[model samples]
Target: MIGKLNHVAIAVPDLEAACITYRDALGASLSQRQELPEHGVTVVFIDLGNTKVELLEPLGENSPIAQFLERNPTGGMHHICYEVPDIRSARDRLLAEGARVLGDGEPKIGAHGKPVLFLHPKDFCGTLVELEEV
Candidate 1:
């Protein structure tokens, strides 16, 4: 039901700075930066060869990223995204297996403009797992 890891999303206070830090300090390269107004956050993608890292910055106080940062100020891993061939089928299987779906009975436009859905963290051993069809 799951394919290769698409990327690891991490919450951060500053997107550009994080990109620079990861670039020079950790040798990660900035692949793209996109603002997701609907989600009230901006995401910067840092390429790491086969995998990628997504840096998320809240655009507003009420944004979920803000709440995430409040819980872990020194922002860290936010979620794990897995590339799925068919989101609906994958979601159905997960639901049949008792995993809680965050989406409301339908997939939504997600980062990279792809259909995406999230499986509740509690269902995945406290790790937020996102399934995306690219």
Candidate 2:
């Protein structure tokens, strides 16, 4: 099943502004910006002692984030990630429970370089959920 809360991902129209807000205004420590081409996002992570906050910007026109931004011009919370001991097992359990997995129904490398899978937002009360293997 699900484990600890991994991180909350927020889509931002402007990555630099979002970084400044979190780094300067909120005084948070942020990781260097990293481009995840496979995920079609450029991301920066803010360290939060117990968890992290991920700020994501669309990397290309076809980026899923781009589609999200089109629907929500201002950008907002995109998804919440949770850790799992075994991603495949977790995926199977979710499937058995009638939860839909996004994409090819396989785990992909995530921001933390760990295996991750996204569940359909509609299946989780309109909130996108990500399962990351720990």
Candidate 3:
């Protein structure tokens, strides 16, 4: 049902600061910043050898990341994404297993421009799970 770990997402109060920390402190290479308006986030991806880390900042007041930051002003891990060969098929299987999909239970275009779905945290040991079609 899950493939490789795609990326780990962290909500940050300041995206640039987070980028600087990863770049200067960790000496990590980063991808260009991207604004995902539909998802209401500004993101930067830090590439590691086998996986990636995503830093997210709220793009607007209504952004979910903003709400997350409200609860955690310092920001923290928001979700972890996993690759799936077939998103819809994976979604269906998760559904059959009684896992609740977030939103409309339909896949949405994610930060990687791939079909992605989020599962309820309560169903996944209090960790928000994101499935991205590889």
lDDT of each: 0.87, 0.92, 0.92
Q: Compared with the true structure, what per-residue lDDT tens digits does model 3 show for residues 16-80?
A: 99988999999999999999888899999888989999999999659977777989999999999
* Candidate achieving the largest TM-score: 3
TM-score of each: 0.93, 0.94, 0.95
Poorest 10 consecutive residues by lDDT, candidate 1: 59-68
Candidates sorted on TM-score, descending: 3, 2, 1
Ranking by lDDT: 2, 3, 1
TM-score: the better of candidates 1 and 3: 3
lDDT of 1 by residue, 4-101 (tens): 99999999988888888998898877877888888888988887889988899998657877888989987989999999999999988888988799
- Candidate 2 lDDT, 1-134, residue by residue in tens: 67899999999999999999998899999999999888889999988999999999999668878888989888899999999999999999999999999999989888778999999999999999999999
| Structure candidate 3, residue pairs in collision | none
Candidate 2 worst ten-residue window by lDDT: 60-69
